[model samples]
Target: MSLIHALQSALGENAVLTQQADRARYEQDWRGLVNNPSLAVILPKTTAQVAEAVKLCAAHGARIVPQGGNTGLVAGAVPILGPDQVILSFSRLRAVRDVDLLSDTITVEAGLTLATVQQEAVKANRFFPVSLAAEGTAEIGGVISTNAGGLQVLSYGNMRAQVLGLEVVLADGTIWHGLSGLRKDNTGYDLKQLFIGSEGTLGLVTAATLRLYPPVATRASALVGIENIEQGLGIFTSIRHAAGNALTLCEFCTQPALSLGAAHTPNGRLPFIAPAYLLLEISALEGARDPREMLETVLMEALEKGRVLDAAIAQSERERLDFLALREAISEGELREGGAVKHDIAVSLSRLPALVRAVEDLVARTYPSLRPNIFGHVGDGNLHVNIRPPAGQTMADIANHKAAITRDVESLAISMQGSFSAEHGIGQLRLLGMAAHKSQTDLALMRAVKQALDPEGRLNPGKTIPES
Candidate 1:
């Protein structure tokens, strides 16, 4: 029979969505960048069902797009390959399979939200360190697929570090049940790494086993106003030196970005306004020194040294979240402020200031009418450099210049030996960038891997690796 009929018959009619309205939510990307309808959207509740759906799709010669929470900044989870592809959504597969407190690992189904995973860790008296603004809705599977980086990446590393093992369904419907919590595994190529950030291009992730940490005891957060990025970098160094591994977050934002956030988010008022700002956090475990005392001392030194213009340290949990609210509200503000030509780029810690300076110079010299909204996890050298229309003008005003602007900005990042796409994976949005920034050798090796893992290019077709 037909693929849709087969899927409906095998996985139940409720699991296979064909009507336009039912598939609408799965079709759109988080940023509203893509909204192409797929031939069908399948919500598989079990790994076996996922494999069954994939096998049927492969038999019918239909391409499959594996999706998680669909909260990715890039359009990685949505279908862009016309109306012939099928979207395999893991939304119904959320299950806390195991929580081994002694082993310090939790095995969960792919559909579990990051926030839910964090809650589970807390319930087990442990901690899951990787956190982003979209944690409330972004699934663990997509987080693993993107190798996502967030605030705590400064200390706990990215999603890649947290993952110990994964359960994935291959393109041909073979389930690789390689879920292991072992910390030491040198038994070959470490196959799970291949699927971690593959963007669902190689295999469809069904579940994962992730590392956990000791629960945080003391916590502190602060927002520092600075004269420029250089001053912020100096402050970051001072705090990192003092707090060491305790420093969990170090975010930078331009004055324009702060203004945008304040305009959009609740409790988004700035404590002190300056040319730029830094939001920092520290979490202490066990017998570690009080984080507030440590951060306060570092901030005092920064103010005294003239590296920071002013600082406001959070006194309570509510106050700390308020401080973070302003930082998290940045993307929302950018969207409301007529959108922007966004770039997720990064450089070395030492080269970050140079990158910022060079970006400012580029915008000022070429697109004088455009305003640059720069902010991100500065501690990790990843910054979102977004170019928006000046004040009153909308994104449409700079529509023609978007291509040239993106080219210039990405070129600068490449010149600095940085990345064109940092934490955000290379979805369809960055396919052109993949071609523009990556070397022939790099592309060839990636293509080779794609060939080996997904020979038919059935998984996430025309994504991640660009066409040569």
Candidate 2:
């Protein structure tokens, strides 16, 4: 029997889709920037089914592209040219396997949405803090595979830090059940780390055991206007000193970003306008000091020290949600305006100002008519620097400059000791950036690891690691 026939026989007819419309849905990524459709789309409902499919594909020497939610910014989740691959989507395996409130861990299927996990934690009176703009649609499997970091990363680290254990399906159709709830284990190797951010090149993650937190009883938020990036940094330090570990999020936004958001969103007006703006939030358990009082004290100190030009504190839950909407909607608003050259980068906290200055000078010198929209998770030192060309420039002209701009910006990031890919993974887009910044020895070691795991190169080829 043929490979397609074998797969269809193993996983029922409803699970295997071969029609053009069915396969087209899994072809493109979230940005609509890439479209590489596959020969078939396999929707597995259980881990055993996934293993059976993998074994069949291995016997046939076929390539498999594992996917979830299909909300990735990078093109790693889609297929590439010259490969008649099969797309294995985990959307049907949407199940919450287990929840341990006392141990503060939850085991969920990879297909469950991040928002659904958060809601499940809330139902149990616990908290799961891995949040992002795409939480409503991004699945737990994609977040684990990408090791995504969002606004709350300043307090609660990235996805890798929150995961206690994972249950992965190997390339040969064997299950590696490393799903332990232990907080500390002196076991050898800690093999689960290998597949956490491997981008599905190592193995397919079927389920995961994630860490949870105690629910916060009181939450407080504030929107502050600052004069410049320097003042924004100063405000961060002041709030950290006053609130300590209670500070959950500190986000920075530029004047142009706020203006664009106000122009696009129906109710997304900035609370107070200045050269720069920041959104600060605090969360605390019951019987602890009032979070609102802590925010007020911190803001008053910042005001006295000239770190803040103006500020507005939210008094109700609705106001807090409205305040967050302004920060979340800016990117969409910018996209609606025109084409942009975007970068997700990070630097040391002390060197952020100098780094920004150097990049700004370089852009001004090279592209005289470009305006940059600078904003991001300032507390974590990750900034999204987007370049918008002057009005009247044709889209083709702007599109042709991306290669040059990416090269210069990535080189500067290397010089500043920052990373080229901060939250976004190194998909096909950053293969060149990785080659330019990564050393020959490091690249060789990565290739060796990939080969050791997937010898046939049958899993998500032409992504994460460059061709040898």
**Against the hidden reference, what TM-scores do the models get?**
0.98, 0.97
Candidate 1's displacement at residue 420, Å, is 0.4
Once fitted onto the true fold, the runs of candidate 1 whose alpha carbons sit more than 4 angstroms away are none
Residue 148, model 2: Cα distance from true site in angstroms: 0.5
Mind giving the per-residue lDDT tens digits that candidate 1 earns over 1-468? 999999999899999999999999999987776888799999989999999998999999999998888888889998985637999999999999999988999999999999999999999999999999889999999999999998889998999999999999998999999999999998999999999999999899999999999999889999999998899898999899999989999999999898788888875788877999999999999899999999889889878888789999999999999888888888888877678999999999899989999999999999988888999988999999999988899878888999999999999999999999999989999999999888999999999999998898899987899887
User: How well is each residue in 162-261 modelled by candidate 2, as lDDT tens digits?
Assistant: 9989999988889999999889998798888898888898899999999999998989999999888888898899888888888989998889877777
Query: What clash count does candidate 2 reach?
Result: 0
- Model 1 — TM-score against the truth? 0.98
- For model 2, the superposed segments whose C-alpha errors exceed 4 Å read 392-395
**What local lDDT score does residue 66 receive in model 1, on the 0 to 100 scale?**
88
lDDT of each: 0.92, 0.86
Best by TM-score: 1
